[model samples]
Target: MELAIADKITQKPAIKRNVYENVTQQFNKASDLMDLDPDIRKILATTTNEIIVHFPAIMDNGRIEMFTGYRVQHNNVLGPYKGGLRYHPAVDIDEVRALATWMTWKCAIAGIPFGGAKGGIAFDPSKHSFGEMERITRRFTYALNGNIGPEYDIPAPDVNTNSQIMAWILDTYLSSVTPQERNRSIHIVTGKPIASGGSQGRDKATGQGTVFCIEQWAKDKNFDLNNATYMIQGFGNVGSWAAKLLKPFGSKLVAVEDHTGAISNPEGIDPDKLAIYVKERKGVHGYPAAEPVDHESFFKTKADIFIPAALENQITAETAPLLNVKLVAEGANGPTDIEGDGILQEKNIDLLPDILCNGGGVIVSYFEWLQNKRSESWELEEVDERLRKKVINAYKKVKNTSQEFNTDWRTGAYIVALSSIQEVYRTRGIFP
Candidate 1:
């Protein structure tokens, strides 16, 4: 049955081109190509719920500050909603909606039994002290109340949020439930500290996953990663870990750019040294190992691969044309906008799309959840092996889909994800 409401809901375009629009545009393209059912398209296109809460937190100076937070549950046809919670001033509804939507596709592509959801507070965590941050996290968790649970929505770390913040959430959430539920509710959130039930290899999961995909690509292209030059856009967890893991593969980090500054070492900067430098300096600036480079020069520098592990839209149409690399492995969500994607496609740059490229975090999060639920702790070697297998499988599926559709990797990933969702909907039918 054709529903007018579904058509209207899916057809209406946003007034401005933003992250949500970018995701929707990609989704619509894949849906059209696959000839997806209209009803399912509508269901997948719209969010299941959008929760916005304003709460007060006591700051260090004894002043109460108001903070706004959002949690957008995109879909759960596959399973429970799962995603990360970011703490940044740019954490608005649109960005959260887009990220949640991507999480839906990301999980489906990875064949994980989890839907998509994302939440965030519109405050900069760097500006707050430890006590203030804890209070804010607890307050946000309290505000969520029954909206999040072990068997329902699960949030991990993203952007400014980390395992410490997740611990606060886990503790706060556990406190709200009954005694019997408290012990079993540790699975309420993933990415907690290892001492608190986090997986052994969870810290480097995202980077390792990206490396796995790259390894697969290298094999297919008969390209060698040994001594290959690469540049990274961010120096955070994902970028740093990716560089560190790739180091053993003989890949050299030639250039790096972060919020602090950009640096380049033509002979290749040592990933271990650069990582420590970033940790101490809070960014790549003043590393003393590499010469400083401007934003333009960073992208224009010659290299074999480019990893944009930073924020969204870092690679736009303007910047895409300047890239001299042969492949782009996105470690960040929505790093390339629609225009930027087009530019890369035009340039024939092989891309490991964000959904497949950066899926390791969630994949390991699944392991963490499983371990917590089963009262088991996996070793680092076991966790790494399992993650490798899962990520490589996802990469092969996406690559095959791209070949079948004669399209780019990004759209191919969406097609694979959407097809999975469509099949579920077709088999189960709609609820009354």
Candidate 2:
């Protein structure tokens, strides 16, 4: 999950189309082009498990509220189900299913030992107090029961979720297990704080990975990053960090948008300063340094790169044409709709698809899990190096696959994911 990595920056989707349908269209296109194995295609099209739980939690107002939560396990043939659990109002069965399927593809393309799963509760976390949030998280974890485990389905933090929430989940899960199994189960969740068995670079892994892909793109296009202009949507973990990281490369951040509002400064906006403002104000709507702008103006801001690090379906047919960018580096899952993808392709805009771009989050999550499982900690530099190598390799694979198949990068990413799984199925065969 290339998560917003903070409070979810959600709004009415840019388009009214079904997200699952969009995802399926992408999947079918790749499957058909690659001549994917029929049986595996059938198996991959549907989810293995869909768990929806209604659990009651005590609110800060001393009243109990019934919260609906869902966990969809799409496929686990590669390894355990791994994905982020989010807290958002629009989390439904279809959305979770789509996200779970994307995780399957993301993990496969990245060559990670994990399948796909996505779980989330449908509610805004901001309306609740800290105690209410904790209670809700714990209750959600308990509601999940044994569906989640260190080796079965490891959960990570997504939108409106962070290390502290993961910590609460870790504790709640451990309390339910036997004392003998507790120590070994620390790998049950990733994105925890350093003291809680998380990896060194898990916090910024997604952003770092996105930047790595951008760097690869720059190298391929012979484009210099110095004095390049970029606009980011969502001033959360992925967007904020990408800005800061790109700033050192001499890229100027001219525009930013979030759930609160969009803001822009054509000359440049200091990511560090904007981040501090967001932390203080919880949004970019009123950042002192940048002037507020309407959504149209924000998207129309011309830049070399546009990182849609917010919600999915943001770049629909309606908004796609408004973009004045040479490249779209997705730092969020399903950010571009099918129409949007077609528009970008026609516009000759290069897209580093989400599966290939956001692999950093899960790759580092894998590292965190490994570190916890072995009770060994890796240094920050080592983690960064390994992440860079894996992201670049995946980028190359996707690029070559796109060229080989003569298709869009999105389709190429799906084909790469499907091909890897196809090989595994052929080697292992079906069970009786």
Candidate 3:
């Protein structure tokens, strides 16, 4: 279906390839391996809608600046479109499309009754003032007025975005609806502040879920979690919370690399202290307990586990060879590209694929949505217990699928997701 278009410009191959291509490659492998139904494959191959909005917002200095925002609805056959909205400089159509597609697979793997969608504004949140950020967030919400709804498309928090941003979006959306619908519409978004209907333990859900999968792996391998050493990339919510949650299991954080710098402390850098330091210094650069190290040194720091909680394509062919870990628990989406994936398989590095490993966030997001809709609020302990069960179940499913197909965990995850979609389409049949 390639259309005749304008002449294309040729350039050198990129070291860090396009994220969308990486995701598509992963999908193609699973589709081929399983002999996926052609009709369902076609439906899953493309997005339902791609919305790019350009709007103006008033800056703190009284100047109106234009911002480009995107929301790609990948699929909604299972239920509604559910994913996160991240505010990062790297936000673009291709990246959002990849993220949206991953969400589809993620939810399907987790057995959550939600499809996939993702959106974000392409700008640096750090450079913006509070007022400016609020105006930008609300403006994006207004621009997406009818396109998003509680039961239709629910947006959660992602990279550089948090409960506060979700709060702003919720308020803006509730105000736009009819007065009678305001109460019912509180479920329009997840990851809201607790007082605003956010689920308890939602803040650390992703990290909790990552640790749960790691625990499952440890049990399967007959390895103990007590006093295990690990390294992490990215000091944001997911990485920090994962480190903190692992503390109870006697897991130690040995080395960490963030955007600011990489630091290592063989004696173990305290997760709580590092978290506090990150909040004050805005990065992990000047932690007094750890020594600053180069990228190679950080990757080479011998440890039992490696968690890449940063951006996409981080563990490429070059970086993959340097990793010295038994397992990789991806707290972030698409952290490993196709080449790196091959390298890891060659090295026998057990991988907890992003879809199965980092599904806690969305699973908890589903909990939050259910709570809001049912007019219920769950306690922290209850939330934690429920998340543990859901994530472990998903972990078992992925492992079983991998074994059944004699394929990698990533492909196993994809097969699980594709099968779910295919079953639904087959049972219901396509619309006329």
Stretches > 4 Å off in candidate 3 = 1-17, 53-68, 87-92, 121-136, 159-161
Write down the TM-score for model 1: 0.90
Candidate 2 — what's its lDDT?
A: 0.90
User: Which clashing pairs does model 3 show?
Assistant: none
Residues 218-298 of candidate 3: C-alpha lDDT, one tens digit per residue: 999998889889999998989999999888899889999999999999999999999999999999998999999999999
Q: How accurate is candidate 1 locally (lDDT)?
A: 0.90
- Candidate 1: minimum summed lDDT over ten consecutive residues — where? 2-11
What are the runs in model 2 whose C-alpha is more than 4 Å off? 1-17, 53-68, 87-91, 122-140, 286-293
Better of 2 and 3 by TM-score: 3
Candidate 3 scores a C-alpha RMSD against the true structure in Å of 3.3
Task: Highest TM-score: give the candidate number.
Answer: 1
Per-residue lDDT of candidate 1, residues 63-116 (tens digit): 999999999998999999999999999777767877888899999999899999
- Using TM-score as the measure, what is the rank order of every candidate, best first? 1, 3, 2
> How many clashes (backbone N, Cα, C below 3 Å) per candidate?
0, 0, 0
Clashing pairs in 2: none
Residue 217 Cα positional deviation in candidate 1, in Å, after optimal superposition: 0.2
Residue 207's lDDT within candidate 3 is: 93
